[model samples]
Target: MSRIVILAEGSFQFHAAKTAVGVIRYSKDTVVAVIDSTKAGQDVAQALQTNFGIGIPIVRDIREALPYQPDTLLIGIAPRGGNLPAAWRWQLLTAIEAGMNIVSGLHFFLSDDEELRQAAEKHGVMLYDVRRPPEKKVVANYTPHRAGSHTILAVGSDCSTGKMTTMLELEQTARQRGLNSAFVATGQTGIMISGNGLPIDHIICDFLAGMVEEMVLDFCEKYDWVFVEGQGALNHPGYSPVTLGLLHGTLPDAMIFCHIAGATTIDGYQHCPLPSLPEMIRMNEDAVNWLHPHHNSKVVGISLLTHHLSEAEAHAEIQRIEQETGLPTVDVLRFGADPLVDAIQRYFNA
Candidate 1:
């Protein structure tokens, strides 16, 4: 596994630094340090106000991290529009010049950029653009998945609502319980963790569903259970298409609705109010049923993200949501995924 130094720079909050957080929490690779000049001297745990990267030092720049002898620099934020920030260019080049591989999840392909690509070649380093979609094109095959296959998708109230985290925990818990489970990744962070999945958001719009279908089908061939990491939200102005593609292509037998507790509106779009939980549930289920009435898929559980809540508060919110939606609700990470797993099993076994 690579020794990673995450580059979050100016954006290092909980939501903005999701890539760095995800890689630290889930990746087997060692995260030696993090780069965020503003938070210099503080560890990632302190900066994020979470325990994810407990003792890892948060440094000021690429040069400061060189002493750690990190072989890789991971671009640790998926910025809006997925473009590489011009300010980060010199940091990446410096890393490359020092023979450190660059792993970026940006839509701007570092490998395709002449300067960076050439620098990488000259230095005998590599640039990994995880968001680059596969070259092949195939339309989604609208058909039933194989018999005995069970799939559950994570849908959410908005982006960064813990969809991938929920799905990942579900898969792990299911596997630990002796079930043959697979996690189908659909985003750059998920890909970084699972090492298998299309950057569905970067794939051509026409082939997005097809790409998802192929991944689900392949996993379903082997695993009895498939937990797909979802992207975006049904009501998101920018990301609804990716959400719909996953819904239609995977035809999940069950869905987990994810939401950050107490969130009133979409992050970065405060003017756009969020739908009521019940209404969002209705919209998601309706979208699926309207497309494939045969699937009879439903939101089987709620994965409420309560990282901001106290333990007591998190429990209270979970209970309140359960009473409101009448579905199994859990934090998954804070608590456990047993309730949601039970819901999926019950839904499928029924």
Candidate 2:
């Protein structure tokens, strides 16, 4: 595994710093340090406001992190447009010149950029643009759906509201109970962690569902349960299509609706307040049923991201969602995923 320094720069928050957040939660590799001048000298736990067990330092720049001897500098902020920020160019070049490989989740391919690519080559370092879609020759065509294949997708109220986190915990808890489980990654961070899965958001809109269907079908044979990591949100105007496509493609037997505890609106769209929990639930079930009328899929549980709340507040919110939606609800990270896993087993294990 690589020793990585995450470059979140000025944008390390719950909203824009999902890549960094994902790594802190679930990287197989060692995150030696993080770079964000704004929060320099703070430990990652303090900076992110959540303890991820390891004490990762936040340094001012690449030069400060050189002593850690990191092999890779990971671009750890997934900004609105997925473009490399102008402010990051020099930091990127400096890391490449120091012979550290670059792994970026940005849609802006660092490997395709002439100056950055040449610098990497000169230093004998590699560049991995994780969000770059595979060549057409390798992208999968839609496959026939299998019967009795249990899949549960983690759809969300907004982007970066713990969809991947929920799916991952569900998989972990399922295996702890001795069930065969598989996780299908749908984004670059998930791909980085799982070492498998296509970056579905990078695929063209036309092939999105087909690619997702192919991914689900591939995993159906080996695992008793397949947990598809979802992207974006159904209520997000910018990303609803991707959410809809994934919903149809996975055709999950169950769904976990993910949401942040106090988020009233889409992160970037404050004017567009989130749908009521019941309304969101209705929309998801309607979308799934519309996609596959004969298949009766339902929202099995709610995976609320409660990292921002107090334990008492988290529990209170959990109870509220359960009562409101009449479904099991949990903060899968703060609380174990047992409740949601029990819901899944109850619904699908029969």
User: Which pairs clash in model 1?
Assistant: none
Each prediction's TM-score against the native? 0.96, 0.93
- The RMSD of every model to the true structure, in order and in angstroms, is 1.4, 2.0
lDDT of 1 by residue, 1-350 (tens): 99999999988887788888888989889999999999999998898777678999999999999999999999999777888889999999999999999999988899999999899999999899998889999798876787999888999999989999999999999999999999999999999988898888888889988878888888888989999998999999888988998888888888999999999998889899998999999999998888768878899999998888899999999999999999989999888999999999888778
Tens-place lDDT digits, model 2, residues 92-164: 9999888899998898999999999889889999999898887762333535466767889998899878899
lDDT of 1 at 261: 97
lDDT of 2 at 185: 95
User: Which candidate should be chosen as best, given TM-score against the real structure?
Assistant: 1
TM-score of 1: 0.96
